[model samples]
Target: MTIGATYLGDDRCDFSLWGPTLDQVTLEILTPEPQSHPLGQDDWGYWRTSLDNIPPGTRYQYRLNGDRLRPDPMSRFQPEGVHGPSAVVNQGDFSWQDEAWRGIPLEESIIYELHIGTFTAAGTFEAAISRLADLKALGITTIEIMPVAQFPGDRNWGYDGAYPFAVQNSYGGPDGLRSLVNAAHQAGLAVILDVVYNHFGPEGNYSRDFGPYFTDNYQTPWGGAINFDDAYSHGVRQFVIENALYWLREYHFDGLRLDAIHAIYDGGAKHILAELSDRLTQFNQTATYPRYLIAESDLNDVRIIRPRPDHGLGMDAQWSDDFHHSLHTLLTGEQQGYYEDFGSCQQLATAWRESFVYRWTYSPHRKRFHGSDTRDRPPSQFVICSQNHDQVGNRMLGERLSQLVSFDGLKLAAAATLLNPGIPLLFMGEEYGEDSPFLYFIDHQDADLVEAVRQGRKREFEAFHASGTPPDAASLETLKTSTLKWHKRDSGHHQILLNFYQYLIQRRNTNPAITTGDRQQIQTQYNNESRWFSVHQSQANHSIWAIFNFGETLIQSPPAPNQTWTKTLDSSESIWQGFGPTAPQTLKGSESIKIPPLTVVLYENS
Candidate 1:
């Protein structure tokens, strides 16, 4: 229904609002000289009006019941902050050069997740375009941008989006985002935008005044759940469903990463997640390039990715944190929070072989049997990463893997993620091992809301038994320090790590076994006492072996018996700042090789 101001060209525009609960709606044009127009309501509770002499870029707001003035629920652009007037934007005005881009397949994707504000000091979408070439050179095929939905203030993790449709004004608004997507397409990189549909930010959200946008029947960690099944939920459902399509259609985003689907409570016959996926499926039938919907769910249930016809949500893929948790606990030896459920060579091996360490097993952290088996699910249905925003930034100090693990351990983490069958995602600045903390930051005008957030961040880390208070989320210094240290990529150990990453990504892309994403052709073996693990992926006559030493001592491991092998990459070599390469370049049948402490070695059959 195009809920916001739709520019009709030639100085004419139409304004529409779904305010079923309100008696009257007045459209007040505040820019290009003030004007007022009373809108007419239909049987569906939709207030709409068409006006002449109304041009594009005009600022306007709706006066509900001739009293409370509010921005459009589906505002296309908020030139000012969330509390400011909404601006009219003609989406068709910009000429696009990515008509031929069909997007990369999900199986072929090597995702690089970045926060626009922290990826560069400029913190604008247009400013981020300058670095697309660097990412492409690193063999990254996809860039998953953190949410750009209009949140309060300029600095945030972007999960606190108040306006579902409007682009954040601090990040150069809609035009800036469009330019970045266009540039990314030109660079042969698919763009995936991280979106939050579970809850809106606490500040500057005005949807409640217009209609039943939230439900009290269920509670999320944030507050009330979104009204996906309550009374008068049709409009609310349409509002969010269309919002997902709007990004793919207007901004040219190749996909959307749905944040925290676990909190999106819906008790309807057709779940909201399934309904959204269905709409995307229909859109893709006629789309020039297929768009994807990836979910972030903690349920660890295979139904999230199963086909819709089989009574499932039908998501293209989901973030599998079990893999990350398994790897993190092993490397850092921290068994707090969800980490209590992991920290064993068997779990890591299970994640490598089955993509889920739990899979209906008992979880000591949850004190219940958690997760279901996904043995039949394809490996591409999961997205795995060693470090991401939640894993790094949620800490008291926001320490990155580079800060917690040794240099050799960092290399091993990179090898495990990049060489796995699941789609690998690298957090921004991890390639060169940027040590700057990606602390959570926000800017809200409400003093009470700000205090609540500050207190909440501290309480959240209590499970980790962290000592110091978290850095102030409202501090400009926190935001400034989170920005990637780009110049460090060419210096000392950072450059060495960066080179190692480049080589691994290149091999993953070209290697038949890893690139196939076929779980049936892979095998994993691990020894808990020795703290060594091996993953072997083979296709036809080609094979690759990735062996790891999680212990702090040297271990002897055989690559495979009765076959010759050549060392492709050894993290213990001097080139990687290791002690030196002690293992021979070539090996024969039944030969046990020495693997240095916390090192990763890759081998290809001769």
Candidate 2:
């Protein structure tokens, strides 16, 4: 079959797709009654046509060489199912108001990661936008939205998206997304979409029929790897690159969080990531704001965020899993799974000092020497979070850190994250300590696929059997339980946690030492036996010290009697609503201070 198209002044008004192996090629146009265009090429295998009148909203599907009709691989919009007619969408037609919105710098970003389906009661992009002002008021500079690409069902976490270009119809489709992003920009919050390029969903994947989109050479835990380095990979790469640009160019998304770069598996001269980053950079040249890319990688490789000029993939940042693990292990003391490798205060100290554990050290869990020092890199290149979707949702029943740690411990965790050097991120409902579990739930037409998901979850948690079996994936209760309790943000224990988070974020934003660049400028001292640690953040002219006590009993180690320091914040004081700032205390060169049980204290040098 021969592919043909005619260009009129840089715009293609007509295009023809041929499948010689089939019976006929019928052009089913949605406008002016669906019309059939007959095959005009040599042999019925060839189809050709050109029309200048067909404009946007002209939905069409080709009756392949004759019998089967399939949507175009390059379909801009699939309002119907993947098998239905493809609608013409003019991306340039949408009016955008973000001309003055320069993208938020990676360093200054305090991201709030959210899923639309659970973020609000309505579960639509427009509905999610209603909370933009609230999020901005909470000091969130960037909103890292979970994937919005079309998946198989009305409700999903969005990682199983098969229609890479189409926004989920249930979430108000393309127009809803455009409005959401525009509204977010208007509210002074940058939108960063989470994109999955690793694998497609189990159902409704038509890429295999149209071309070789998957490769058997490598496999991800979810499914087969995308064809990134194989023959015909150019088209596949173009498809993904175009999707990335589409979100930024058409929807005005400020950035993207690339889901699972370790599963990308590219063995080519120029990796797909390098090409994608280059294209994004080119687009940024003309765009009003710079676009950014963040990768989710388990490899702990700094190359993921390193620029292409330095022989790296050129992502703007990456989620620091080590930091999360260190914090989680310290707070919960649940040493199951990968957490078995981390628990001591030393682990947290290492994460604070070097930004990664197992950096050049042999990891018993992976059975290899993993990670490298990120000391030379800017702290902004790593996004740190005490609780994220994976950290919460992947649990046996999707329990958050709040479930295991005391209210004081929760405040301490907030202090550690907000005061750290990296970009701080918080999972949805985490700021208020919502008790709902973010379980894995999906609505697939294929019952076998549903059952497979259930079985997979059971096997994944075999090691953590004590955590209890995961909520049944097939139950509607699972999805319902994941929804955020918005009312909790203002009452009871939730209100206390919310206030603590706000105060920590406010302090982080206002203090130069807390938000500084160099990781080397930070110093950490911890006693492994005592289960206590002190983090001192110092710049050329100013310094702030934070002390955390994780033990069960209160301990007094005499205050420093020579050097004077003022208490800026503490988690133990009732007058401060558990957020304390004590009067100035004098300290000697080798003096120590009293630390309460499960409390954190911050001191600023006078």
Candidate 3:
């Protein structure tokens, strides 16, 4: 079926659609006035037409084979539901105020990852802006918002987004997004949006109705993979690439966190990742500030962060799940599922030495060699976090790190994450040890699909059995249990955790060694019997050491010689729940320093 359009002097309107198999196509204009126009077919089977009087703000739908009318697959705006008419949106209408805003560098970024629905009571883009000051005060350089694309319902984690181009109407639509981003920039924070390109959601996905948007060549957990290399794949790719550029050019976004790139299977001359990276680089050169791409990859392939000259995908950075797993397992001692591969002092030591835990070693849980070492790459290419959305929400019940580890352990984890070489990303409400869970919640309209989700969760955890079968995914109770208790942040234990985080962030920003981008300059020393590790970060001649005690008992470690070492930040003080003040003593040959259990200490050498 073809779509109709018309053009007038200084104002033009055109309609085009893909439906080669159909015999005829018709365009039904639903706004300004109701009218129908017959469309002409091209050699490739797409129908098109032009209307001389029609202009911007016109709403229309295309009739397939002159029969049933449907919304445009590439609709820029969807004020109504997916079944509603496509509106003509002028991308240039919104005025942006971030012309002088240069994007944040990947290495220096302190990312704050948040889901809008759960971030605030209002759960909209505008509401999120009100909280940007709090994030900025906490030293967050980038705001990584979860997906905002339109889904089937009002409540979702945004992984099930169906409309790639349209903003969720419940979240105050496109203009609301612009306002939030502009406000964030004014608050000295860059916005990095998380986008999913792997597959469309199961419900309300209508791309297939127009043309071959999916192919049977590859299968994903969601379903058939997107037709990246098949017939009409060029247009499909164009549609996605255009969407990406639209955000950068129109919305003034700083970067994008590509969601679960491993599932985006594609085999072509130029892989989609490489092409997208190249386009982003081109955009950066033309634009004022440099933009970045952060990939959420499970493959542990260093190529995701490697430079393009090395025949790599050239993403600015990638999320490091190994760091989180190692830290979480060490603190919680929960050895189930993937955590079965971790929880040893050696594992924590290895993660401290190298950013990866596996490092090409055999994983008994996976029954194979899982990952390779990323030592040669800069540490800035990896984003490390103690807790994040997936790690917390995927649990049977969304439980924050505070639930799994002690307060002392939480301090140690925060010290390790913030002072580490890689960029640090803090999950929302983690600074103050918010006790609320971030459970997997979805409000799907389809009853059968909801049942399938419930069964899927049960089956996923069936092997563990220790955590027991998770609660029904379809239950509203499960969703309610995930909401954060804002009152807890002002209380006893939670307030202490918050102070520790703030202090660590302040220390990290002031310490040159902690913020250095060069990975090769970082060194580590550990003792298997003592269950302790000390990291030395050196930039030029300046150096600082971070010591962590993983065992229950106290331990002593020698300090580096010929340096005036002072106790900069110690987690073993009475303020952090340790014994007393840890006095700094000068080192001659073997200086003894006591490290409290589950504590981290930082020393600056002059």
What does candidate 2's lDDT look like per residue over 1-606, in tens digits? 113232232233556543433445567766646666664544433456777566666677766545667776556566775456677666666688877788787788999999999998888988998899889888889999998777776777889887777788888887889989999998999999999999987777666655578899999988889999987677678778977887787688889999999999999999999999999889888887788999999888988888899998899998889989988888888887788888888989888777788788898777789997786678888899999988888887888877888888888888889989888999988888888888888877688988888888888888566545678876767778888889988888788778788888888877778877877778787877888877777766667777888887665543432335676677788733554433235444456777778888777663
For model 1, state the Cα shift of residue 555 in Å.
0.8
Candidate with the larger lDDT of 1 and 3: 1
lDDT of 1: 0.90
**Across residues 324-407, which tens digit of lDDT does each residue of candidate 3 receive?**
988888788788888898877777767766778887789888999988778778788889999999998888777888888888
lDDT per residue for candidate 1 within 1-606, as digits (tens), equals 777788888888888898888998999999998998898898887899888887788999999998999988789888888988998888888889999999999988999999999899999988899999999999999999999999988888998899999999988988899999999999999999999989988888999999999999989888878999999888889989989999999999999999999999899999999999999999999999999999999999999999999899999999999999999998999988888898888889899888898889999899999999998798888999999999998888899999999988899899989988899999999999999998989888889988998888878777667788889889999999899999999899999999999999988877777754567778788899989998888877777877899999888885464567888899988888988876788877667788888988888872
The worst-scoring run of ten residues by lDDT in candidate 2 lies at: 1-10
Error of 2 at 396 (Å): 2.2
Best by TM-score: 1
TM-score of model 1 (CA atoms): 0.98
Candidate 3 error regions (>4 Å):
1-24, 40-58, 466-469, 475-480, 558-562, 581-589
TM-score of 3: 0.93
Stretches of candidate 1 off by over 4 Å are 559-562
Per-residue error for 183 in candidate 2, Å, reads 0.8
Better of 1 and 2 by TM-score: 1
